[model samples]
Target: MVCVANTTGRAVRMPRPGGPGGRLLLAGHTGEDPAPEGPDGTVAIAPHSCSWWAI
Candidate 1:
């Protein structure tokens, strides 16, 4: 697998739980998944530390 070296910060917004006026925003590396979905989000293996949260 090929990985792009990125240092700039980025954010991805997705529909949050519930209905209107709800949204989920997460910041991290942007990559693709070549496998099926699991119980959690896409699995990512990074050389550095990472985290995920919901607000």
Candidate 2:
């Protein structure tokens, strides 16, 4: 899971989880791209949640 602490008083936008195709890391397909956290897509307001897996 990814934890983001925004000390700055501003709303932050993050990329949609898993990017396009919703790719995820697999045991055998380790070479396959495990979608990463990036600065691009949606916005998660406090009290809500943004989720990701770190592989």
Candidate 3:
């Protein structure tokens, strides 16, 4: 799990595999595209939580 801070500096849990998706969510709705994924393919975030994993 990756620990990230928001605009308010609140640390939140995120997935290392799907970091891009999480990063976008933390962007405060900035309409920015997420980071590129590695060769492993983009990760998917699970509902009810910010956690994610490779499918």
TM-scores for all predictions: 0.20, 0.30, 0.22
Clashing pairs in 2: 14-41, 15-41
User: Worst ten-residue run, lDDT, model 2?
Assistant: 25-34
What C-alpha lDDT do the candidate models reach, one value each? 0.30, 0.37, 0.35
lDDT of 3 by residue, 1-55 (tens): 3422234333333344444443333322333333444455553232223322232
> Residue 48 in candidate 1 has what lDDT?
32
How should the candidates be ordered by lDDT, best one leading? 2, 3, 1
Model 2, CA-based lDDT: 0.37
In the range 1-55, model 1's lDDT, one tens digit per residue, is 1232223343222222232332223423533222222245443323332333332
**For candidate 2, lDDT tens digit of each residue in 1-55?**
3433333444445544444544332211122222343555443423232233342
- Superior candidate under TM-score, 1 versus 2: 2
State candidate 1's TM-score: 0.20
User: What TM-score does structure 3 among the candidates reach?
Assistant: 0.22
Span of 10 residues, lowest total lDDT, candidate 1: 13-22
Error of 2 at 40 (Å): 6.9
For lDDT, the strongest prediction is: 2
Name the regions of candidate 2 deviating beyond 4 angstroms.
17-40, 45-55
